[model samples]
Target: MSQTLRVLGTSVTLLESIRQRAEAELGIRLQYQVHDTQTAQRIAVMHPERYDLYDQWFHNLDFVWPARAIQPIDTRRIALWDEINDLPKLGRLHPDDRLAHGSLPCDRLFVQPDGRLGSRPGTQISMLPLTHNADSFAYRPEHLPAALAGREESWSWLVDESWCGHIALQNDAAIGALDAALALQASGLARFDNLGNLRLEEIDQLANCLIDKQRHGHFAGFWSDDREASALMLGPRVHIQSLWSPTLMQLHRAGVKYRLAVPKEGYRAWFGGLSLSRCVQGPIKDAAYAYLNWWLAGWPGAVMARQGIYIANPLRTRDHLSRAEWDYWYDGRPATEQLPGSDGLPLIDPGEVREGGAYAQRMGHIGVWNAVMDEHNYLVRRWGDLLRTAR
Candidate 1:
């Protein structure tokens, strides 16, 4: 009899292809409940018993870890733990690379002897770091003002009054607040001591500035998922906005002429991985471990790489990708020929190069990571006010 592993996460990793592959290879039945970031976090924190594993971001640990919703993963159980790169293990690919601000995965990776999460190395981990990338907004070059066509792309553009009424932002509070803060700071409208974690006054001041913009019709709408983001970007409703890697691939397949900006300020990065639900044990727990191991395996990482995410074990993933894919996506070289996405559809043009260059260069430029702020509760309420007032 096959034991069912109930997995909860966003559509990014919980794809139909992945589910089918896992069941066929691991001999376990799988059940997936995919939700947007906000809803998934709410469920994982409040009702941990409903799922066997939680596939989400590291920043989310602030909520789930404190709620005791997840169990630490033993490194020995991870088949390819030794092969994993230093980025998640040490918080930087190279020792000299400064850690990006926010809730970095390494900062909360290990399980301390006292049963709390910390950066110091240990045999147990809060989550197995998997797919990750540096994120920035994209825009349709043709839609931009002619004067700005040759100018360097920037986060400040998100706040520029010239682009007001045509901009959109991702709707989640934590991620969106950081996006807005970066924009505000870049445009010289506001300053923050730390972009990742906002103080109470910073939250209020940021919200007030955004609310004022909302009254003047600064935003078209806020999107909670890729579908809404795609709609806003594809239609004439929005010219530019915050975007994820997968959404960019979708746009490429649809033949949208968009530019994923290499922002002057730097990218807002994120790391996504899987964690064991607190209630999972015995055979179900073993199956859960198998799933985590499967993610680090070559094929799965290749699938995610087609959409621009970098797997934690890059060398293993490199084997599964074609030379053109390796050159274009990882090495930052122009594509020798059109490359196919995970769905087998052409996603890259022959002469096109990735926006921010090679993996090392791109990862080195991270400004702030997606985070759960210290004043997250207050931020949420104020964000809600911004949303309500915007509509």
Candidate 2:
């Protein structure tokens, strides 16, 4: 009899192709529960018994680990652990670079001897590093304001009054709040001592700033997922907004003239991985490990690469991609020819170069990582208030 493992996560990795491949090759039945970021995080923390595997971002580990919702993953059991990049082990792609702010994956990677999470390398880890990307907003050049014609791309444009009533933002507290704070600071409207961890007063300041903007019709709307963002960006409804990699790909396939900005202020980065539920054991636990190992085994990473996401062990994925694909996606070369997306349709045309150059070049300039802040509970309450009142 085939064992079954249920995975809980947002749409990032709960993709149909991944699920089908895992079921076919591993001989295990897989069930995926996809939700918006907050809903999925809540269930993973509050209802650990509902899923056997957790497929989500590393930032959520702040709440999930402390609550005992997920168990440690032994690195020895992961087939590609040895080949995983140093980014998760050292917090920086290179040893000399300063660590990016927020809940970086490396900071919570290793399982300490005291049974808590820490950076010290050990036999066990909090999550298996899988896919990641440096994210920034995408905009339609035709809708860009005249005043900003010669200006380099910057986060400040998200709040600039010239573009008021035409900009959309991601509608989550943790991720969206960071984007807002960056914009507010870039626009000289507000300041935060640490972009990653906001004090209560800082949260209030952000809330008030956004509230004032909403009252004046500065924002077009808010989006909870890439699909919603895609709709908002289509036509003339929205000209600029926070965007994800998959959404960028979708817009391209639909013939939207979009450019993923290389903001002067840098990008917001996120890393995603898999973890086991606290309640899983025996046969199910074994199957969970099997699924985790499969993600780093090349094919899945290759699929995500086509969508512009970076795998942990990109060298392994390199083998599965074409020469043109490897050059365009990882090396940041202009497409020598058209390139297909994960769906195997031409998504990138020749002569187009990736916005931010190579993998190292893009990942090097992170402004912050998505985080569960120290005052996350308070942030959530105020964030809900802003969304409800703004709408």
Candidate 3:
């Protein structure tokens, strides 16, 4: 009998494509019910026993635990759980490229192939990495910031004194945390110094910049939503901010011009990978594994690239790609078939992704990052307060 796989995925624009892929894989076609993340969370909790797998933005790992709504993953039962064969290939995946299997974060205390890892919240040997990416500058105009500095182009220039207040940034920590960390890193103001864990001081810097720019009448304001950011940039209230490719692609479809930049110091990013659900039964698990392997090998990456959304699996090579295709896939080249000006040419040398200095996968680690950033929200709220007080 064909086994059924009940999975949850984000309702982002990629929903349709992801659904089609699952249908093709399961043969029986998955019962994919799309909902906002909140609804998905409720479904996961109410029917943990019923779900074969709960697909989410990896950030779901944060709530998965506190809500106590999941089954323990059966590592021994997973048919493809070959350590020697899979771990090396997966473990060696670019640290930020946590979207692949077999890799763990910094060997921290988790139920991983290595041993008990650290205290990074739900990452305690639970959950799995699904997809990962580095946050970089996505812009148009082709005026490379690093080049203007007599340096290579970079997304980090938005944080510099020269740029002052005109910048774009994502409000979601998972999406924009790395970009904040890099901006702070450039100013020597931010680092993983807090608790020796990767940290980002996003709010303070943003507030200060907001205040500074207001004082000089040079600041435009930090963007809180992707659509809003794009609109502002289109209206030209904002010129730049860190953005992921999916949104950039949509903007391109809207006829907005821009490019993606993997800065010299490296772009900051977070990623997730797929792990079979402990609740899954029947041959579906093997099929899921097949899908996972295929995804890891790069079908999803290629598809995402076509949509201007970059996924992690570097080895996941696409078939019959032209130079323009490669640009959109690996080099941040624009989807030239549409956005002719956006040829997302490489701005700087970010080194190879296979090496370290890239993003590290933090499976089931949404809570830790959230707790840290929640305190950071004081700054965000404070920015609002400042605008209010001024009025």
Task: Report the Cα RMSD per candidate.
Answer: 1.0, 1.1, 7.9
Q: Model 2, stretches more than 4 Å misplaced? A: none
> Taking the tens digit of each residue's C-alpha lDDT, what string does model 3 give over 312-361?
43444445245555654455433455222122333222221211122222
Compared with the true structure, the alpha-carbon lDDT of candidate 2 equals 0.90
**267-290, model 2: which lDDT tens digit per residue?**
999999998899999999999998
Error of 2 at 332 (Å): 0.4
Q: For candidate 1, which ten residues in a row score worst on lDDT? A: 141-150
For model 1, the superposed segments whose C-alpha errors exceed 4 Å read none
Misplaced by over 4 Å in model 3 are 1-6, 11-13, 29-52, 56-63, 72-125, 142-151, 154-156, 160-165, 174-178, 188-232, 252-255, 275-298, 308-391
lDDT of each structure? 0.91, 0.90, 0.47
Task: Please provide, for model 1 over 251-369, each residue's C-alpha lDDT reduced to its tens digit, 9 standing for 90 to 100.
Answer: 98898999999998899999989999999999999999989999888989898989898999988988999999999889999999989898878888899999999999999899999
Every model's TM-score: 0.98, 0.98, 0.61
